[model samples]
Target: MEDDNISDTDRALGFTIPARHARGRIVRLGPVLDTILAAHAYPPAIEALLAEALTLAALIGSTLKDAGGQLTLQAQTDGGVVKLLVCDYKGGELRGYVDFDAERLAAGPEQPSLFALFGAGYLAITFDQAATRERYQGIVPLDGDTLAQAAQNYFVQSEQIPTLVKLGIARRADGSHVAGGLFLQHLPEGEEGRERLHTRLDHPEWEHVAILGGTMGIDELADPVLSLETLIWRLFNEEDEVRLLSEVAMTRGCRCSPEYIAQVLGKFPVEEQRAMAGDDGMITVDCAFCAQKFPVAVTNVVL
Candidate 1:
């Protein structure tokens, strides 16, 4: 189900601290995270990286001006255990996958550094507007200790908006995974336009907000019991006022189906399609994000 308002655990929300010239988003993923991660049976390190990517997607994607727009976070590397990582979000739906060298990962330390996992990689955040068909993307090197730190650098270095992010991942006693994140940005006091030319390098209000966000612990963030609203109030309770936004529910949204698979297979050359068919004369396609297989009969594919 999408946007189910009954539960608060698997949802993301945006809020603003007008008094401090700042805005932020927080997300806590429960069963949705478990479902997507369990489908692939990835290694623990890969799972943690993917979880952070998903959390960043949701935290940033929720800010899309057009509800129909899509936000994609991609990381590519060379000469590393992890080769590529991708995650996308649209209308409160998220799906992500990671490609890594299993043998190399097994030989590495139990908890590898970002450099160990991705020797030389870059992180890209792209937004595809729904109505305008316009695409905006920011690319930055994987330079920080954690993905969250890299994201903060993304906004500061690429977008030039001072930002901070705290991402957390945890496993329950039952061995189920969960993730959460916080994204805060300083909107300097200036003109009411997309480009606020008057952004200060050392804004006092932004520092106050960032310091508060930095105080949050990973355990506190990944805790399933804390509501999103509570997390916000906990940080800004002493402030003059804080406005809460409506929550957007999330799920393991994988855009894959048999009909769609058949349509794609119909595009391939008939000879190539037939050559790829299995013993049953069917071309089987597996969706990487969902780990679901779709078999289309060669006879039905006419390209």
Candidate 2:
């Protein structure tokens, strides 16, 4: 059943329907990246690197709810040559950082592959549960040519889930960046649900869904063609009925805060804190994601 508030067309992208409410999510990941990562002038290769991470993070985070569970996506390569972490909790808040050879920036986007930036790295996906349940973690080698393909490989090899992904990025006329993407997955249906995908698996149903999603171009993301309503309707018009649930609004948000920094500083022994503070008796914390620095006085520490 489609909620009266949601039109079938609108469910195409950028909102979360509760679990079982909807089977998949389509996302627009750019513009937000430019806002968060492009403020500082990074060379083109690094810029693209961050852009891909941001896009991947958005898609991964879309799977769960912000109220309790948060998804962390990590790409760590050899000897700190390339290490990036991007986390998007259920709340839509996101933060991430990229580390690579500054000289490599001159090497150009084509020269450095995502893996080259961080050689011999692995991709890790972790689900953090708030309810005292165990956190779940999965790892896959970074093997694919593009981030999307790498993630797709991660699904097949690590999780054994059949998934398809399409990612497109573009720069806006005003210089902001925008990225658009789609994800389609076929899972074992319930006795009845499984009966459906299975019955249709041999048929053209899965292919039909993938083909429509792949057609969406950069323009659809930069500026949506139809509201989320019409888009979903048009895509699933073939189904007996597609159910659209409550809308979840998403935006660019960072979870970093002063108290969070204090906790990190507290992790060190009091003596180590004192030594790091030096004669000034202060410590500095810079957000890896946005590079914003927070300076705190030693006196502020209860220790």
Candidate 3:
């Protein structure tokens, strides 16, 4: 019961269960994820962690109020394998990178839990909207077994909303990486609305949907052969109504450009810029997000 019409690449489907009063989002990342991860040669564990970060960013960023806004998810840790992992999302475009202690990663555990890999860290979500002068940020401790759990914790702690997230990452037979995720949130009803609906803050529908969502396997989540619609139906078709709201296309995009790089370099003193120049008398900078290198002439760097 798969949909033959839609491509199995980067896409997100937003849906809702009106009877259950729940909202959910499902995303599949194919070439978009492969391209982003292939830019850097990271260890398997580090790569998996980065994939989860990117998937979480996409699920949460799609909820941004402004179309021109960007959402960034960052994890800063004092662990052996990872120092920082950042993912940026804007208008369905996503990019991410990981910073790890090479020596530590080489000697670390073969397979560590998310908490072990990112020990004693904080997860921060920041919203940057072009229309607003001030950016908004929320920080929560990383105390979960997985990145999705951390995100769910954020919503429960910061927004006071009950949320659940399931994330999966795997390598295809061809050695490329792909990721998928499911996000569900219970819509809070106002006091009057709750009375009319006979729904309490701890509604039974939320637990019911979450229990059904827990049945999803990682393979089903990450498999390109499986259609998102099929997955949705399999999960919640038994409900009164499963409505598809919209679908968004995603791509591997980076915000870094030569002009932007030059502007950042301009902030430094000329002497400092000169000190950063290579033997060829040019300053080379590599974008942390995309790993794209931009070489600028030392003389062209305005002080």
Per TM-score, the best of the predicted structures is: 1
lDDT tens readout by residue for model 1, 246-301: 88898778988887777888898988888999988988898889988888898877
Error of 1 at 47 (Å): 1.3
Q: Regarding lDDT, does 1 or 3 come out ahead?
A: 1
Task: Estimate, for each residue in 1-303, the C-alpha lDDT of model 2 and write its tens digit.
Answer: 334562121122443222222255666654456667764466666677666666667666766653577778888776434656454545565656676667654644555776667667788888887766668888887777777888888766666655666666666577767665566565444211343223333334446555666666645543433355555565566566555545545565766677877777787788888877857788877777677888877767645
Ranking by TM-score: 1, 3, 2
Number of clashing pairs, model 2?
A: 15
Considering summed lDDT, which 10 consecutive residues are worst modelled in model 2? Answer: 7-16
Model 1 bad stretches (over 4 Å): 1-8, 189-198, 269-272, 275-280
Best by lDDT: 1
Residue 156's lDDT within candidate 2 is: 68
lDDT, candidate 3, 1-303, per-residue tens: 665565475888988888777888999898888888889878888888888888898888886658789999999986536788899999999999998888877776877787777888999999899777569898999977888888988977776666889998888788977789999887746211243244444778788978998899888888877888989999997888798967888998797887788888999998899899989989899899888799998877776
lDDT score of residue 26 within candidate 3: 92
* Model 3 RMSD, rounded to 1 decimal: 3.4
Those runs of model 2 whose alpha carbons end farther than 4 Å from true positions after fitting are 1-22, 79-81, 108-112, 191-208
Question: RMSD, each candidate, Å?
Answer: 3.7, 5.5, 3.4
